[model samples]
Target: MMKYLRYALLAVAFLLCVTVALANRAPVTLALWPDTVTAFLGFGYAVTLPLFAIVGGAVGLGLVFGLVWEWLREHAQRAEAAKMRRELEQMRRAHPETAARGATQPPRDKVLAILDEADGSS
Candidate 1:
């Protein structure tokens, strides 16, 4: 599933680049830093196309990064939780005193029995 999603993202990026290249065929002059040169850049033909690509690529990369970061973080958290759970289980298994005390704690039956006796007296 992850492999397929990666392929889909790649295809989308390719299509976007192709679309930009196709739509922007003509060249126009660019006014770069400290120079108003007559240099013809392809992007100048359809300014919106490259702008869309740049913005979309940045956003797409950000999404992928965030997804990976979240997955890693969640994985780490689950691993830590699992370790703690295992440690607690081990302690419970090793300590007979703790288990005995926990088991010896009064059950609900005693409370119900006391209530029954009180009701009978009343």
Candidate 2:
């Protein structure tokens, strides 16, 4: 089933990540400036972290940025959808009779409506 296949895939991915982490357990120094620049500036920041941690952090940051970018790009669509919903509500309130009739109307397909009635599942 799809559920089992998905679980197996997830397991494989987890194992791969674990293997990578174990293989890259050595500490890596992350420096903000070159040695010469640091010497001239008299101040530089650096942190030592496991290579796996750095790699994972970069991947996580990329995902976060991508999500934010997409949300920003879709802002207009979201705003338009909200505007249309408000307009629909206003129209529904303005014409209560039409809204009621629309709700009671049968499906567009006459054959489907007949079948639904016959099955008593309309």
What is the number of backbone collisions in each predicted candidate, taken in the order shown? 0, 0
Worst 10-residue lDDT window, candidate 1: 38-47
Q: Kindly report which residue stretches of model 2 are placed more than 4 angstroms away from their true locations once superposed.
A: 109-122
lDDT of model 2 at residue 79?
Answer: 100
**Maximum-lDDT candidate:** 2
Under the 3 Å rule for N, CA and C atoms, how many clashes does model 1 have? 0
Question: Per-residue lDDT tens digits of candidate 2, residues 1-122?
Answer: 99999999999999999999999999999999998999999999999999999999999999999999999999999999999999999999999999999999875898886887999964
lDDT of each: 0.74, 0.97
Error of 1 at 18 (Å): 22
Per-residue CA lDDT of model 1 for 1-122, tens digit only, reads 99999999999999987797667655543333322232433322222334455555668999999999999879978999999999989998899799889889877698899999999999
Displacement of residue 3 (Cα, Å) in model 2 is 2.6
Candidate 1 whole-model C-alpha lDDT, 0 to 1: 0.74
Q: TM-score for model 1?
A: 0.30
